[model samples]
Target chain A: MRNIWTICRKELGGYFVSPIAYLLLTMFALIFGFFFWNILGYFVNEGMEMIMRGETVPMNLNEQIIRPLLSNVSVIGLFFIPMITMRLFAEEKRSGTIELLATSPIRDIEIILGKWLSAVILYSCLLLLTALNFGFLFLYGKPDWKPLLVGYLGLLLQGGLLLAVGTFISTLTKNQIIAGAATFGICLLLWVIEWVTGYESATWATVLAYFSVITHFDSFARGVIDSKDLVFYLTGIFLGLFATARSMESLRWRS
Target chain B: MRVLTCFLPPSAGTATVAGFDVLEQPREVKRRIGYLPETPPLYPEMATSEYLRFVGKLKGLSGGELEKRVDYVCERCFIADVKQKLLGKLSKGYRQRVGLAQAIIHNPEVLILDEPTAGLDPKQINETRDLIKSLAGDHTIVLSTHILPEVEQICEQVIIINKGKLVATDSVRNLQARTRGVESLQVEVAGRDGSLSYELVQRRLEQVPGVAHVLCRDPHEHRLIFEVQSQKGQLTRGDLARAVVESGWDLNELRAASMSLEEIFLELTGSDAPKETAELTKEMQA
Candidate 1:
């Protein structure tokens, strides 16, 4: 546990010292803020028109603005998670620092978890920064914070799952660009796999749709935390981390 | 080196470091060994002190001891001046020193340094060599280098590996002694009258017991230089001196030309080694 924490702290400290962390933080905040502004503007305009027509329809901020905003954050993550994760193993290998880590007394699992945890923390910090924008919504509007919390939870699980995948791909190569691109490709595929169900509702299509990240994320976006979706995200994250552990083990001999 | 350091598992064999199996008890082996790859593993963004602290922590040092060890290694490696500087901004020599400091931080039982002085200036090389020599008896240093002279000077035991196979492993003294048995003595002799006959001298020298071959070399000034090869386990110097004096020739110089580590390395590793030299290497391996 000490070894894992040592590695985690080192990796976390690494992110802050390099420009990569600030670059990622600013970019995520900017893009998410743009989506937040555009979505809220549209929601307000719709509410005003309903009021001018003197209709008694209630405004649902959670459904109208928050759901799409959370969904867009997941989409933005498809681009940024790879950038955050591509360097975990690839940079270590390229700079020959993997030798130090490999030869150290720490277990392979500890090293893997430490790096993945740091990546998660960095991504979470980005999520936390965007929470400031959510604070403004809370100050003026009465959108139930319950659904917003669930939406953020869904986004974290989905992002964590993709980060784990990116962590595995990062171990496959020493080139960070290749690792990032491969992670992006794999994440995008997971996002769009539900499209096949739209055309054909066959059994295989249903299975593919079940595998789609968006299919599970939709429930959380709508303020419902389905047990099956939670299980799916958790299991997917475990498998990704399991695959990363296997890759780390192979590195002992494959080199 | 990687296999021994617990970095990479061997394909078909098992190794132990400090009585710990690399495959079954890798953490134990790792705990006792400090490894420095050809390129030192460093993060560019880390300050030297921060990096050393991290390595010490990874090696199981904590609290005041870790802090003290970090300061000691910093002073020992001559990088105290750059302790606050980021590794990326330091020069190559300073970086190598920092790499070395990390390896010695926990003061493990074994230190594996590959090309420790590879990119350093001459002064730093000497300082690094002195530091390694200073740490010799207390720590088991497995220094891997391509510089033969460095091996000849710093190492007590030398293990020569050729094509991933053990070629020779012996004390530096013992390996250097390979220059002696069946050795060739360079003898420069001249006739007393400032003239000499190469044929006559060669004939007289070959008559000495245990002398294998006497090949005449070019005359230098007034002396005829002959490389008198001796048979295995024979020291023909006394008999040769007597024979040259009896033949009425002035013996100017007679000394064994010791073989260098480079020559021994080549003889053992070279594909085209002479028959006798190849046998010598095989004998050493045995």
Candidate 2:
């Protein structure tokens, strides 16, 4: 556990010491702020239209605005998670420091957890940035905080699953660009797997749709926390990290 | 070295470090050994002190113990001056010392350094060699380098591997003594009034007891150089010097040519193989 924290601290330090972390934070906040403004604007305009029409349907702020915003945040994460995870092992391999980690007394599982946790933490920080915009909704409107918390939890699980896959891809190559591209490709594939279910109803298409991360996150976006969705995210994370550990073992042999 | 350090498992055999089987007790083996690869495994963005602390903690050091070890290694490796500097901005020599510092920070029982002094300036090389020599008593160091002189200067026991086979493993002096029978004497003589020819000098040297062959090389107007080979299992330096003096030739210099590690390395590795060993030796020298 101590070894994992030590590795985690160093990995986090690696992200912050370079301009990459700051650049990522700024870009993510800007994009999320835009999404927040657009969503809130659409929600207010719809409310005014309903009032002018004398409709008695009450609009729930959580569902009308926050849910769509949370969904958009997940979409934005598809672009940023790759950047967060691209350097986890790829930079170490390129700089030859992977040898130090490999030859150390630390276990392979510890190293993977350390690196993956760091990425998850950075992704959490990016989510926290979106919270500043959410703060406005809480001040003037009676937005329930519990569902917002649930949405954030959902974002974390989905981001963590993708980060694990990125971490695995990072171990496969020393080139960060290649790692980033491959991670993006894999994440995009996971995101779009649900598309297959629309065109066909075969068992394979159903399986692919089940595997899609968006399918699992849909319940959380609607303020629903099902145990099955939790299991899916945890299983994906476990498989990704397990594959990374196996790759690390092979790397030990090859080196 | 990789197997012994537990970085790679052996394919066919078992290995141990500090009494821990590398394959069976890898954690114990890792706990006991410090490894520095051919290139220093460093994160350039990290401050030197921070990096050392990270490595120390990874090796299970923490709090005051980790701080103390980090400071001790920094002072030992002469990297205290660059403790706060970013590793990427430091010079190569400093970076190498930082690499050494990190390896020893945990105070492991064994240190495995691969080509530690390669590509360093002469001064840095000497300092690193001296540092390694200073570290010998407390720590068991396994240094792998292509530089022959480095082994002769630093290592007490030498292991020479050729084409992935162990060619020789013994003390440096013992290896040199084993090759002593092939020793020759190089003699530079000023002839009487420049009257001697190459054949005359060669014939006189060959006449000496235990002298098997003599070859006159680089004939000059006033001096003659002859390389004299001793008979197998015989010492010929004293006899050849006396023989040259008695023959009325002015012996300016006569010394037994000791076999260098390079020559021995070639002799052992060259005979069994073809041109690859020669190329490898040349590469090592470069």
Candidate 3:
């Protein structure tokens, strides 16, 4: 546990010291804010028209506006997680530092957990930037903060799962380009797997769709917090991290 | 799990270090062994001090212990001068030294260095050699290099592995002695008759007990060569010269052969088959 934390601290330091982390955060805010602004604008216009028509608006303001805003943020997250994770092991292998770490007193599992935790921390910081949207929503109207918090929770979970997958893919090759591309490919494929496969395969697709990261956003988009959705996200994160540990261990001894 | 077998397959054999089974106790093994690959592995953006502290922490050293070990390793490896420098900005020699420093940070019982002197200049090489020698009493170092003289300079017990198999493991002096007396004696005979001089000298030298083979010829003026072989702890060079004179052949010159480390290395690594004649011809020219 101590070794893992030490690795995490050093790895987190690497992210902040380099330009990559800052650039990723900037991109995260710009894209997520844009998505939030556009969605909020459309919903406000719809709500006003419903009021003018003398009709009760059916959708909850948080459900219609903030949830959709952060869900789109989760989609943007899929692209960025790989960017952050592509360097974890791929760069180490290319620079020949994998030998140093592998031969160290730390276990393979410790190294994987350390790097994964660093990405998690970076993603959390990036997610914090989207809090501006939630703050604005609170200022503009009498809106409940419950759904917004849950939506952010789902988004955080999704980011964790995606980062783990990205870090795992990074261990597949020494080339960063390949690591990045492979990570993006896996995330993109899993992201849209349900849409491409059609309804005939909806059972496995629905199960995979539940695991798609997009599906878990549903519970958070509303004011609901389901333990099943939480379990799904946790499982995804665990499997991805487990696979990463195995990948590193196998590569070291395969020589 | 502190030790694990590497390089060779686990099924073939196993080695334990500090009560760690190399296969099962790999973590414990890693904790007790400091390994430096051919290339130094380090984060470029990190300062030398920071990186060592990080590694020390990962090795489970406490705060005070980490700082102490980091400084100790840095000072021992002579890298304290560049402790504040980023690894990327440091020169190759400094980087290599930093790599060594990290390996020894945890003060493992055994240190494995693969080609530690590579890419170092003569001065740096000598400094590293001296450092490794100084570490002999405190640490068990297993360093691998193609440089034969280095083994003679530092190692008390040397093991040579070729193509993934252990070829020879013995003391430096013993290895030298095993090839001793197989060395030829070079004789430059001067002012002697050309005809009987060649034939008579060969016959007289062959009669000596330790003389396995002799080749006497007029290279410039006249030279006689003897490839001598004797049972260990047997005979002297004076006996051979006396025999030549007793045979009514003039003896003008006689000297025992000398072989450098390079020659011995080639002899040891070369084929064990009947290539002694070809190697002999090459050695004579050398």
Q: Is the docking of candidate 1 incorrect, acceptable, medium or high quality?
A: medium
DockQ leaderboard ranking: 2, 1, 3
lDDT of 2 by residue, A85-183 (tens): 999999989988988998899999999999999999999999999999999988999989988899999999999999999999999999999999999
- The fraction of correct interface contacts reproduced by each prediction comes to 0.94, 0.91, 0.66
Candidate 1 regions with alpha-carbon error over 4 angstroms: B119-121, B182-256, B271-286
> What is the per-residue lDDT of model 3 for residues A29-85, given as tens digits with 9 covering 90 to 100?
888878877887888799889999999948676767776777677788889988999
Provide the lowest-lDDT 10-residue window in model 1 chain B: B277-286
lDDT of 2 by residue, B74-140 (tens): 8899999999999999988888899999889888888888888989999999998888888887788
Q: Stretches of candidate 2 above 4 Å error? A: A50-57, B192-196, B219-223, B231-250, B271-286
**Count of clashing residue pairs in every prediction:** 0, 0, 13
Best by TM-score: 2
lDDT of 1 at A176: 97
> If scored against the real structure, what TM-score would every candidate get?
0.88, 0.93, 0.83
What ordering of candidates by lDDT runs from best to worst?
A: 2, 1, 3
Candidate 3, which segments miss by more than 4 Å at Cα? A40-61, A196-208, B1-11, B183-258, B272-286
